[model samples]
Target: MSTTTALPHWDMTVVYPGLDSSEFAQGLSQVLQHIDELASFFAEKQVQALPAAPVLDDAFVRDFEQVVARYNAMSDEVRTISVYISSFVNTNSQDDLAQAKYSELQRGLTLLAQQATRFTAWIGSLDVEALIERSQVARDHAFPLRKAYKQARHLMSPVEEELASELNVSSGSAWTKLHGNISSQLNVPLKIDGETKSYPMSAIRNMAFSEERDLRRLAYEAELAAWKSNAVPLAAALNSIKNEVNVISRRRQWESPLEASLFDSSIDRETLDAMLSAARASFPDWRRYLRTKARLLGLEKLAWYDLFAPVARESKVWEFAEASNFIIEQFGSYSQRLSDYAARAFRERWIDAEPRPGKRDGAYCASLRADESRILANFKPAFAGMSTLAHELGHGYHNLNMLKRTALQRRHPMTLAETASIFCETIIRHAALGQVEPSEQIAILEASLQGSCQVVVDITSRFLFEQNVFEKRQRRELSVDELNELMLDSQRQTYGAGLDEAMLHPYMWAVKGHYYNTGRSYYNYPYMFGLLFGLGLYARYQQQPEEFKQSYDDLLSSTGMASAAELAQRFGIDIRSESFWRSSLDITRQDIDLFEQLAAQR
Candidate 1:
């Protein structure tokens, strides 16, 4: 628990001096004006209500290019400030100004949503291939255009879509806000030094990684109690968000909410099915790893609190500076560009790594302008800490590679989004395992296995839980108790004999922010997708390091332009094949075998 040193706060000043600054105000004003003008542009160009097969003359082609180009340009302007406000809101949950500004910004997004619906609806009737040939902008945006057209099948009328968009600000978005505010501000009671003290949820969560078993147990109990206390609103938020998704999903003529998510993910149902099948088959292996970990901890079965309890033979505390250097050096082994990008991110203070009360939990990198990204992390001093840095910097590097593309072109789906990050994480893990001493080897290998299990096993539980919630929510609102039961059931199904069933986490539905997001469903599976997909790609990179670099960069850059299957094809990997996924799983299976051998030695 050597987390005394202060982690660096990112350089937000570079984005904008402050919320009240002239530039910030101008950004807000500019977006408002652009949306208004965009609406006018839609109206003037007859962008709404196009004929089933509109005459694609030269004039129409020229006008359509402007429409798509303008929309993309406007999106960049909108995202620049949108991420700025979010960075503040996410970092400081109590930042009233940032919250207010974000709400205000959503209004403009609502109007933009209306315009986008109209545009999407209009594109539905067009000959996408014909238009792609005629307009350069159309060619550049062919993937998004085709996607919008395909999505048009599920959309309501422009009027209905607009109404839904407007209501989202108060319904989905507001409920999500409530969950975040409550979760971040939540202070759970924990006993320390004979005095009961209240710690913010983030601090309590970080303690999960702490080596102290008693402390971890206490934090787990306190966290569950806190969530139970707040479960009413959190459950309401979950219900409302899910119900909204169900309503809209049905309205859009989607067969299921999962189908809509599959669409949004730019991945097909077959691909997901393949991945999950492989994942389910590997569950026993993961359970074996868990059992071995339990044995190492001198227990028969692990409690939920012990899942992330660091298992290291020779433990090392990775301070912020040390972790940063380690990440940089490992990244350099892959590519100097990646190494340099990570170095610059650290040098320029592009990360806010401090774990504090107001700051939210987890780590994510938000692409601000062009290639610049701001990463938020609650950095704990361990192998996981350094790996977290590498993971986020991988995201930053992904953004850097896509710099030549427009904002719309860079808008990749969640399934593709995690690949680069996990790829970087693998780099750090693999490099560290090879170089560390036998004692540290146990530490690094276990840490790596711990992370893989999370993505594979824990994520499977979350996906199952979300599925049941969605299925039941379609009938009626679920009670808090019902949600807990569903969560426990999913955990039981996934973890099986690996964990003490009585000690499983039931409030995981409330703990994860993934479930609270109304815009996306099935956020859990994407991590699994990323982990396996990334492992597969990394394997290729190792065999043909020289040839793989450019091809790999191409795949990352083209993520937004193609489906997951299509991208996988470029690498000669069939995402829809269970064998492909099984191959990826086998990579982790080897590690699990190694871990069991090491555990036997211990």
Candidate 2:
């Protein structure tokens, strides 16, 4: 529909001219100095050990609050430094200086974290509710304080905690970084139009969404071969990271790694179980959709590679400028606040949309500051790419909504992180469907359904794979072969008869970066959570358009301050109930029904 010769790149000058800039150096120095100041203040108070006779007088509470306030201030400054360095490295992972600076900042942050352990441990020993009631500052930070106290049992001694932090720099973190380096540099061999060429794994993977079936199959085969070549080292990274998590979780007295993840997610086992059960129940509808898709493509069964193949012959190619304007307009129709934020993001060069060498494969939106958010994506002139832009911009909009809150209050759990992003994506997608010609409806519907299936079916498979990996890692280290087997088994169970058994992806674990994070386990289900939750909210909006906007805004604003369950409760949503999840899945089912009807017409 629209075309452009060049896409946009982020203006990092707003952050710093370079890592060598005076501002960058000064920021790092200030962060270190603040950490030293915090360490000195706590050490002077002799707060490193548990007090034999604890007292909570007015003077003590005032001084404690002052220290906490100072800590929060310091934390904000350090976060600014961390966010800039992370953004730089994410887009330039191969840069040695950026990588070195990231490591340095990580170590500095770990040291600062070690210094805070004493204060946290002291807080843990105190009566949090009484403290909150007694002091205004404590009341203001009740959520974080109470959470820290609840987590006190899992905290090791200050020395042990520091050692763990230091070890992670070279252990878990290093392994994950190595995996990133390896994956980013991979070149998959694909034969396209009688020419056998070696392309970046990312480019080949993008071909999965191509309109050409033969090309998709070729890309899939090459991608699998590439992963198989590096499976051993990738497996090692996975094993090491999971083992670290398993040991730390056990030492922290968690029942299992999953329990620790739940604690971090601020959700309980009951809620996760309910949501997963609901997901399983919706498998039949998803399978039916898959069958319909296969028939439309003239295949008896769909292969893993065919999952994203375009169902329509004519695909729309949207230019970068056109897509951005459309998204802004669509967002404006819903809320001027959201549209304004998206407009600012594009106008201020907050997004990097160009594809280049040594860049990361996936897309993400980084909240660099309270008021500033940066998005990184590899843009193409396809509907899928436009959807991606909307998704990342959705994250930007979420960050925009949170600009007024404190740093601590702006940090939402992963479970609710995708709410705004998915919501925004859905907005643009449905709007496109409504405006497109009847002949173009199937492609639009297929694209939407592909995303839905990913969040539901594929995410379920990842959850199952990670669960099995954790369970098995507790007994012993799993070999590369075992990991492949486990992944294949998980896929079989999740995809069922919908996907061709002979063509299912066995190297999925090697490709997904989710499993490599040592601090977070079971990082898959949140997609399912975010999608279903957003869909339910979207459905609610349809019922009462006038009232839902403010409610949605309020919900996004409260994400950082409340738990998932608490936030859902604000909208009268019982996230712990199967019926609530079913309501969301029912919307997806309706889309599938429409897709089937359209395919039949074709």
Candidate 3:
């Protein structure tokens, strides 16, 4: 087997030289000055008449436009600093300076939020329709303005909102940061080749994809032990974050935490229900796939840790360069624009793919601004790692499509956020299936099916777990043992008899970062939405290979501006219908059948 490949470190020169650089200092100063200026403008006597304006006249429009432009400018600068610092921290989570800058940035953002709330409240009090029709600037910002007006109902007084934001920096966000630091510092002890060695959680977790079953099991046990060691503090962090969300959400007059999440997702309850119901109906098929995987591994029942264990004995490893070239080639086969954008990302060093100590776990693509995005991944040479690279590159492709839009218009909801990345992943996976030998085909098929199961099956479990947490958390703080039981119950409900009951992962809440975010509740369902939605789009692309290219780009570009239902309608997809979701699941069903046949032959 090849040793761990040397991964690429992203170039931060585009934002600044470093945290200590003069450029960074100047940028920070400029951002602070901009914030103060905006705050003063909001406090001006002239702005006092904003809410009482009876007519949408030229003067009113001009003043509003100026405020909007300044706000956007301030936001742009803050976002640039936020992205750079966040990228640095993602790769070096233990850096005290980065953490300090992050906290400072949060405070700066709170000040901006105060100004923005006052401004938005004034705008919301206006005749928005007339403003949009009369002013071209308002017309350009119609969607965001309209959304702000709708969301204004939930906004507290500016003072209260500002206080909440500031308090979160020390309370909710502080707890989250503590959780991250603890998780990053953890060392999982595994006995490899008769010698006990300690590995970081991220490194050890990757061993789940190893072909060696013993290694996968050992790593899994060690990871569980590590989590167990920190369970008490992690549980406190989870409870505190969720409780903060509950308090603030109630103060905002949201019907429920889940309702607020749905509003934020730009998806309706009916659509979410339809999609989740479809997923539940498909659990039988998912279980069949799992059972097949267990049989191939010579186990009567698969454990939770065994879920990611490789079924293909002939899995091949791709070097970092090989994976990059392959991803570029696969993207080119679909669209030259996507291919070119990915090539630029590679050439410009926009990706940080190295696996090292102090780096945050998992992969993500951060949109620094409209024209730039930074991708971070812990790249290994295995097929799974290659797929992860493709996934993040897909996110870059989505950002590229939205580059021409305004900053506010480029903010897509979480439901539509996963579309491009998952679509890109499907593209490469199918392409691989066409080229690989039969045994290798099993590896590719297993990898693809395993990914679908995560989105469809595992995400459902997470969604259920979070739902239970919120329901129980409202009554009282849950103990560590109670949280574990809730997690195990959710898994059983979602995974059914597919997994061994004895070996389930109970500390999942401790490891998953998604649950810790107070701002974004119920972050699980979006993966299911993205996968099914992307597959539905991919099915259309397969049907009309040439014509669907533009439609795909159009969909990606519109994601930031339209609702998920509206975007689906452009391609004649009815997301609220169960049939649409089932069609996507049918693709997974076919893959499972193929896997079963291959396993029988083997």
lDDT of each: 0.89, 0.85, 0.86
Report lDDT (Cα) of residue 51, candidate 2.
48
TM-score versus the correct structure, for each prediction: 0.98, 0.96, 0.97
Q: What number of backbone clashes does candidate 3 have, counting pairs of residues 3 or more apart or in separate chains?
A: 0
lDDT of 1 by residue, 1-602 (tens): 66777779988899789998998888788888888998998899877756568889988888888888888888888878888999989999998899889988888988987887888888897899999998888888889889988988888877788889989988998998899999998988899769998899998987887778999999999989999999999999999999999999999899989999999898888899999999999999999999999998888899999998877734677889988999989888888889899999999999999988888899999899988999999887888888988999889989998999987789899999988998999988988888877777878888888989999999999999999999999899999999999999999999999999999999999999999988888889988998899999999888888988879888899999999999988888999999999999999999999988877886
Best by lDDT: 1
Worst 10 residues of 2 by lDDT: 45-54
Could you give me the TM-score of model 3 versus the true structure?
0.97
**What is the full ranking by lDDT, best candidate first?**
1, 3, 2
Question: What is the descending TM-score order?
Answer: 1, 3, 2
Q: Which number leads on TM-score?
A: 1
**Could you tell me which residue pairs clash in candidate 3?**
none
Model 3, 1-602: lDDT tens digits are: 45456678999887788898898888877787778888898776244224464576787788878877777777777777888899878888888888877877776777887777776677767888999998888888887888877887887766688789879878888898889888887877888899998888998888887777788888888998889989999999999999999888899899889999998898999999999999999999999999999999999999877888888764567888888888889889998888888888888899998888889989999888766889998887767778888889899889888877776777789999999998999988988889889889998899889999999999999999999998888999999999999999999998999999898999999989999898899989999999999999999999998888868887888787778898899889999999999999999999999999999999
lDDT of 2 by residue, 139-194 (tens): 87777778778887788766787788789888998888988988887877888788
**Which scores higher on lDDT, 1 or 3?**
1
Q: Tally clashing residue pairs in candidate 2.
A: 0
Error of 3 at 96 (Å): 1.7
